[model samples]
Target: MFDADWPHRLHSAEQVRALDAQIIAAGTPGFALMQRAAAACWRALRKQFGEVGALTVLAGSGNNAGDGYLIALLAQQAGWQVQLYWLSEPAGLRGDAQLAVQAAQAAGVAMQAFDQQAEANGVLVDALLGTGLSGEVRAPYRAAIEWLNQQTNPCLAVDIPSGLCADSGAVLGAAVQADITVTFIGLKLGLFTGAGPEYVGTLVFADLQAGETAQTAPSVAQVLTSDTVPRLPPRSAACHKGQLGHVLIVGGDLGMGGAVLLAAEAALRLGAGMVSVATRAEHVAPLLARLPEVMVKAMRSAADLQPLLARASVVVLGPGLGQSAWGISLASAVAASDVAQVWDADALNLLAAGTLRAPQAPWLITPHPGEAARLLAISSAAVQAGRPQALARLCGRYPATVLLKGVGSLLAEQGSAVSCCVHGHPAMAGPGLGDVLSGAVAALWAQGLSALEALQLAVWLHARAGEQLGAQGRGLAASDLIAVMRRLLEEHAPCRT
Candidate 1:
């Protein structure tokens, strides 16, 4: 339910600063922008702590501290008890920040030096640092952040949570975990990904009338929400079964047949006109019994798979595809198939191991962090540290469009801006979600959307479904997303009923 025109554009810290410079060059003074930012923070603080008795302002000597001072002045005007703790001397402040401190003093707002044992109760306002942070927290700031985290009071963060990297969402040595974060101007990419979500509780954004025109280059990523949901329009009444594409699922060797079955069922449920499965001989019977609509096959070798592969418009490769001889042979064959493909799970493993060549057709790869880490020859921790860089390296290294799945799932093609989806639920972190996601993307591609479009639509569909189903609580299995996804696609991007 995100607004279409809301600034979905996610800026890096450097980019936001550039945008601010542009705004200043375009007639508005730098101090005017600072005033607007402070007002926005002040207003949000008032709304959030309407009934709170006391307020504590944690201030630094940057523009961020300027915001805390303004909030303090606002609280004092309303007759609320306020304690302003400046980590650095406000007398040494420069630029607009110095002006803010002077204004607060003129208004009779007394700023105090930082004291660790002070009675720091009430609504805490964190303006210790801003998006300028890129490395670990140092010295007195680190101690202050540690002390603030130990407090049980409701806290509001100005701009972003202090000490969180504005570009990668990595924490410095420490970060202030606030109950609310009021971000201004451009939305920093860090605020939505990595450790950002954990630190930034309930986020509020204000454009401060920066206007639609960009003073600098546009950002490289945008959040995919209701406004950016890639989907086909409602189908015409004249549409027939033949109009939708056929999807074939390959993999599920030996005892792991359930993996391919989940993929096929997902494709069928998501509106593929026809679905087929190519797996071990023993899997045919159980698959037919479980999902009779899916045409099942006993593919012992590549020869057995080609007929099914030739008939398919889209191929879903690699769920439960083990590393045995049988799996390797089938994976090699599928990787050479002419139809468009969606590679997931073991397929990515095989690709990373160099046992298989990249797919012949335009393809999409869905990899969780471990798989991505393996593909990039880096640790999973490194992948989580800088998702954007990992995604860029992946797209550059492989020919396929990529979806790096995690807290904030990122989808990108070789030449496009990375599209991020933040609508997923925490419960969606369970097993089989990736398998279902691969199937949905293949189904959408077979139905005629481009590879990137299919990925964008499928990822959001899968995640949004998880959000809805997850509301029922933590037992959200991967299969839980299918029905919800089908219903959502029909409601949002309906095929002819």
Candidate 2:
């Protein structure tokens, strides 16, 4: 029951089957596994509710149902009133679940089949669908889920809240929103992101005796936590500003100087050696007025920005760059440059329009779901439906890495796998966060990380910073986060050996 490995243990349905086979091959009985699952559920239920004597267990016709029945047996043994409402006919339950039903009967745990007059007076345990669900929830299950939602009592969901896509976390139809979720085996990706956090409530994990060998199976990425992020490369007393690398931020069309200004300021605060901005001549004065340390260059066209681009170790593009001819032309030039890049905002839109190509050098694109939808030529609804697949698609179409921003920002590369940034607060929903992320990512790239590593680290740091800022309260403006970003970089930056 190592907390960190729980996620890997509660895997996709296919992975769960493989691990189950592996355990059975090791001579553990399938029924034993069922018993273990039931025990785990019973423990979680008691821990969350603190020894309430009465219970209502919602049972379906699958392994999940078996777990529910076993829970009833445990409650009866503990001298509590328990009601098992079988949403499906109890006789329809087969395999270990059937055995569980028989055990519950032998234990004298009261059970009934879908009584419309039933009312949940105590805690409800949802043991309906597990990770095997696909598409929309059908029939009595949907009705039952809705009815469960109407109850005033707290709920405890088994494995995942039924109706959540195990991989993507999207609700298939009506999904149970539980007060506490106890997941077994592996921690399905859906449990941490999308609608998962809201429906899952307080998450608890149980392995049911699945071991580390089960952890080695296939996975796109795991959720990112504080312990997962690595320290930045160390700096020495002998090191000078020149060693840190220069980042050139290009964008900020007329009257939009704030965009590139934010990017440049963020890059500097994150410890880039030198931060420069290449934008419309009118922007140069205003940028310098705000961020005096930044070197602002006036660019009449793409050619004027070429030498600066060549000098920059990394480029932050598309911040505040509107979709007019000037922005499109400059974006084309930046796309063609060999400089490593952090692409955002209008730059991403330009790329989607086919006016720009994926850069040959290392690059990271930061896009919210809407931007991702445009890049993939799909609706935002579709992109949100399958975040992992959408992220994979973006990484595949563009050779560079991508940071798909949302509740759980995903970082992935075409050749490598995806990793999620599971930190950050809801306060991060305010404006200019993406620009901050772009700058931070570019700073990391300039500091000498591979594209994938840079994107992963950048997203993690950005989210962590917001988490720290939002610890006090909500309403976090993007500017309110700058100091935290600097402190995080300084504290975690590698200490010279």
**TM-score for all models, in order of appearance:** 0.96, 0.95
* Candidate 2 per-residue C-alpha lDDT over 1-497 given as tens digits, one digit per residue, 9 for 90 to 100: 12553453224566766777788778988889989988888888888899789889989988889989998899999999999898888888888889999999999998887656787968899999988898899988888888888899999998889888888889998899899888877677777667777788888887787776466766657666546555667877798878888999989889888878778888888888999998999988888899999999998888888889878999998998999988888888988888888899999998888878888877788889999999999998898788889998998888878888887677777766567766778778787888888888888778777767667777777888898888878778777677787787676664465
Write candidate 1's Cα lDDT for 1-497 as tens digits: 23356677788988888887888888998778888887887777778877686789999878999888888877888788888999999999998889889988998886788878866857999999998876788989998898899999989999998888888787887999989998878888888888888899888888877885453358968898867778776678887867899999998888898889889889999888899999998999999999999999888888888888878899988998899888898888888878888999988998899988897688889999999999999999899889889999999999989999887788898998899887877887777788888889988998889999999999888888998998988889888789999998888876654
Q: Pick the candidate with the highest TM-score.
A: 1
Q: For every model in order, what is the number of clashing pairs?
A: 2, 8
- What lDDT does the true structure give each of the candidates? 0.86, 0.82
State the displacement of the C-alpha of residue 254, model 2, in Å, after optimal TM-score superposition. Answer: 3.2
Clash pairs for candidate 1? 136-173, 137-173
Error of 1 at 460 (Å): 1.0
Off by over 4 Å in 2: 1-10, 495-497
- Global lDDT of model 1: 0.86
